[model samples]
Target: MRIVSLNAWGGRLHEPLMPYLVNVEADVLCLQEMVRTQGADADWLVYRDHGIELLQRANLFEELKAALPAYDAFFLPVARGDLFEGDRRFDSEFGLATFVRRTYPIIGQAAGFVHGEFSADGYGPHPRSRNAHCIRLFDYERGYPITIAHMHGLRDLEGKGDTPARRHQANALVDLIRQVKHEGDRLVVCGDFNLLPGSETFDILSSLGLADLVTSRGYEDTRTSHYKKQPRFADYMLVTSNVEVITFDPVAEPEVSDHRALLLDLK
Candidate 1:
């Protein structure tokens, strides 16, 4: 079975992303920076930030559902606030989303904040909360149930260095994983960690006996054309020792989003 992870970048590059999603045809897709409008179509919607920068987004959850009709969609919003489309304003929600093929029997699922609490005070520059979404599914092809958890890690705008808060966040994420996983269940934990190489966060996750596939495979970079100044700022996919890695690729050919997609084919 194939699993993919990507930071959708709010679907800012929707044109390329749409076709890429269709072609990849992954068994499971975990996406961060996913945006959703309460009651809106998947049309090109423009959100302006004081006329300085424009954020173009669509109802990505609905769009993905339409594209991958056979996949079960799950979304959890970590931030909610008002965004402006010219003179009109509308409420928007942003967070993580996981899509699993219908054939995969999902036995358990859970989601919660891993860094900071949800901001009821709107989405303006106040350290936004980050969350982890975990789903346990029976991989009929492999004959084992695995718990996969995905999260968009807290962003430290100043720099991507190891910080105390990040250490705390890592602990929180590990705790969330333990809550849903069993003693012998194979596990996969991943997402846009926003962490540099050799960060303490990796050590924290390693304590749970998870292997960081990206680092272990010696992949040096995961950024696409969208990220010019940032190098090696990438996503990750980790799995337990019991999981057999059939193939792993940090796909760079498709400039679907600023971040490259992580693909894992496992048994």
Candidate 2:
């Protein structure tokens, strides 16, 4: 399977990213900070043109209610952030969101999108307190199937070592990982975990038997956040036990968001 994960930057994108089909896309996509209020056209366009299902909200949740009538929508309200790392708020003030392909019925749900309290602090002076989104995806139809955990955590905060919040933030996701993974079932975790390969969080996930897709292929894990020298490898496509990492690259064109798109293929 191949997956593409991005923060979406904001509610809107440039002309290039507006009609997302023109750009490289994903079979299943997870977008964060989508500021689509009720009846907004952002997700509607994806559904209209590409047939991708969406799960999100804007000023109100009415549009989500109507767009996805078959399945109930879940919201992870944006709250305060842990001050330990730093303080940065979502530009859209939205939480991480999931849009299950309408074809797949959900068997489980997360507590909410917001991991920790999000302090309304802008970046610059203090470190930015960032959290990630963890969504567990299941394919139960195949007798038994794989479980996917999608997340986007904070990266590059100055005081990461001193704070327990960053580690605690991943507790829920780690718990989800333990519960969903079984002997026969394959486990895959993707999305922007926000930590670099050498970071403690990355090591923790690795200790659990997960391998970074980019690292295994000998492809430099860089590219995602524009702030990095090269493209940063904050976004990840990791597999547990072991899975093939066929291809990984930043999209060549149809430039979607400010962050370069990372693509992954696996057997």
**Predicted structure with the largest TM-score when compared to the true one:** 1
Cα misplacement distance, residue 70 of candidate 1 (Å): 0.7
> How high is the CA lDDT of each candidate model?
0.84, 0.49
Q: What is the lDDT of residue 90 in candidate 2?
A: 21
Q: Write the per-residue lDDT of candidate 1 for residues 89-138, one digit (tens) a residue.
A: 67788888899999998898888888887765576563468999988889
Residue pairs with clashing backbones, model 1: none
TM agreement with the true structure for every prediction: 0.94, 0.65
In model 1, how large is the Cα lDDT of residue 21? Answer: 85
Model 1 residue 180 CA deviation in Å: 1.3
Model 1 RMSD vs true structure: 1.7
lDDT of 1 at 145: 88
Best by lDDT: 1
Instruction: Tell me how candidate 2 scores on lDDT.
Output: 0.49
